[model samples]
Target: MKVVSSRDFNQDVSHAKRAARIEPIFITDRGRPTHVLMSIENFRHLTGQTETIVDLLAMPEPRDIDLDGSRPTTWDRQAKFG
Candidate 1:
């Protein structure tokens, strides 16, 4: 990773960002690391480690739905009594 002083960061931000693509760029303040600049793709790939709701829905259902309607369902039986 490349390290840039806070003062240099403002003057050479474009170069610093280009360098960050290969790895991370550390922004230093008084010789101490303060922040990091990374590529969006890398950031998303690292943060998108969990399964989203859309991904879960795209998968198959857990079990059969029993959509036959041939069996006497609750509504069918209730109508006879009521």
Candidate 2:
């Protein structure tokens, strides 16, 4: 892992980004580590994160949903006569 001060990172952001592709880069502020820079693939792999619900919903519907009156679901109900 490469360590760089915030000033250095700010001065050469491009270089830091390039180095991050190879390994994580630690960014420091006032001599203490503040953040990390890493490739998106690496980050995802480390976190094991998956696509969110919004992402799934945004995708085109793969099949048509049947909402015909032929099938009644549990929600269907009737009022009993007094």
Candidate 3:
């Protein structure tokens, strides 16, 4: 793990990101830990999230969609629900 001050993190974001690829980077504010930087893969593994954005985007489009636009009649609206 690497520790970086907020000022240093802001000044060189690329360096923090590079270090995150290998391990978690702890960002501190006023000598107190505030945030953590890590690769997306590590985050997903830690959170147990398996689906990626790419997987969601690659899903097949719905083939059958009900587009009926008819409005309910007054009698239909008055029907009781069990």
Candidate 4:
């Protein structure tokens, strides 16, 4: 992990970005940590947003769904609308 002051970060944004590719970069303001800079891959991993098609396919199939195929009666429609 790398810690950079806000002033230093603003001065050399590219360096911070490069460091973030390997690990998180902490940006500080007034000598306190304020923000983190990290690669998009890391961000997605931490947020659990890195699902692939294989992951989707690996989920267990749903079961026992019931469907009603009957058409609604005219009286049922009228009662619903009123």
Q: Best candidate per TM-score, number?
A: 3
- Judging by lDDT against the true structure, name the best candidate: 3
Better of 1 and 2 by TM-score: 2
lDDT of each: 0.85, 0.89, 0.90, 0.89
Listed in order, each prediction's TM-score against the native is: 0.55, 0.60, 0.64, 0.60
lDDT string for model 1 (37-76, tens) is 9986678688985667887799998686777776565566
Clashing residue pairs, backbone N/CA/C < 3 A, model 2 = none
Ranking by lDDT: 3, 4, 2, 1
Q: What digit string (tens of lDDT, one per residue) describes model 2 on residues 1-82?
A: 7999999999999999999999999999999999999997798789997777986899899686766766555554453333
For model 3, the local distance difference test gives: 0.90
TM-score winner between 3 and 4, please give it: 3
lDDT of 4 by residue, 1-82 (tens): 7899999999999999999999999999999999999997999899989878987899887885435656553457557887
Candidate 4: residue 68 Cα off by (Å): 54
Cα error, candidate 1, residue 19 (Å)? 0.8
Q: Candidate 1: misplaced stretches above 4 Å?
A: 49-82
